[model samples]
Target: MVFFGDSMLETLGRVVVFLLVVLVVLLASLLSLFFVMLRTKRILFPNFVLFIVSLLYEILCRLLSFFRVDPTLIDRVSVEMRNALNYTEFAATDPRERILLLPQCIRSIDCPARLDSLEGICCVECRGCAIGELSARSREIGIRMYISPGGTFTERILTRSKPKAVVGVSCYPNLYEGLLKAKLMGVPAQGVPLSAAGCVKTTVDCEEVMNKCKIRS
Candidate 1:
């Protein structure tokens, strides 16, 4: 009995060491891919890199912080990678089957839009901010637009609307979460990162958004 117990302990120790080695290898590979992407603005082995990023997201961020690097760098790269991976499917969806979600922060400070339980913010196109122009363009292409009040509202919109594809504009962190959510829901989504991020009076690149919205061609 004593000999069997000792063997069991040794086996467990070996398994733990193997897992630690694997973790270190994955972390090193992910960091290498991240630096390459940053320098080249190109993704290599995108799906593999994304898997590592998702698997070690928290730990990787903490590691970056320890090295005095901006942790959100990985988040930004992951978002871009997701966009590239989903672009073909997203572009194939019909305009009518797509929806555009804009963050509430991008709205003008004096915006007159009112929030509803069902539809979120109702944009009246008062021309107060880029949203009005975007709303107009979305209408021209037969795509529905929503100004999300928060993450919960965004989920509700997706659940209720059930669009085939989505175009979302937000900061990098929110964009990363939103993309992952869409993927889990079996929806293809394209994200446009906000040019200036803030709680209120934020700014987005309206032209870049329109370009993404019409990426079908």
Candidate 2:
């Protein structure tokens, strides 16, 4: 019994050490990949490599478990991966008080597809897009989130809200407008360009927004 207990302790120690090493390696690899992507502008390649690495790592972990090899290392890797993925969702600071959300264009009162701000408008929550979710989250965090239809209304909202920073989601034109506003107001701001993939509503990941708002600690 004494010998068995000792062996089990040794095994546990080895598993812990192995898991630590794996976690460190995984983090380093991800960081290196991020830097390479930035330096080489090889966006698609890095994304592909990350996917492959993640898949292979999971498979290896499963295989190890099938052979009764301690899965602690794999489990650790999974947790780390999840955390990294979720990191984008985490706001590094409680700057909720300083953040704002704005919309690029307002919807037409008659047609959902047609955007019209010729008369100056605002998002009406009629399209059921990310604006609603972002508003809710901002409310929860005490941040000011608004959906202004035009630059004029956007400035109005910003002035009333008196935010120290802003987060805008829109197309290139609106993004540029928001940046200009930020500069003029001396407020820090960030923008998320809408992609052609049409993920404006439910598909928008709050994690991505969080990533944009993340501050290095």
Give the clash count for model 1.
0
What does candidate 2's lDDT look like per residue over 1-217, in tens digits? Answer: 3566878999999999998798667655654664465466444343344354455556554655876866444333332332343333333435665665645432223424334443233345554555555656666666655655554777776776676666666654345445656656866566665543232331345666655654433
The TM-scores, one per candidate, come to 0.92, 0.44
Query: For every model in order, what is the number of clashing pairs?
Result: 0, 2
Distance (Å) between predicted and true CA of 68, model 1? 1.3
How displaced is residue 141 in candidate 1, in Å? 1.9
> Each candidate's root-mean-square deviation in Å?
2.1, 17.6
lDDT of 1 by residue, 69-140 (tens): 999898799999999999889989888899999999988999999989899999999998889999999999
Overall lDDT per candidate, in order of appearance: 0.91, 0.53
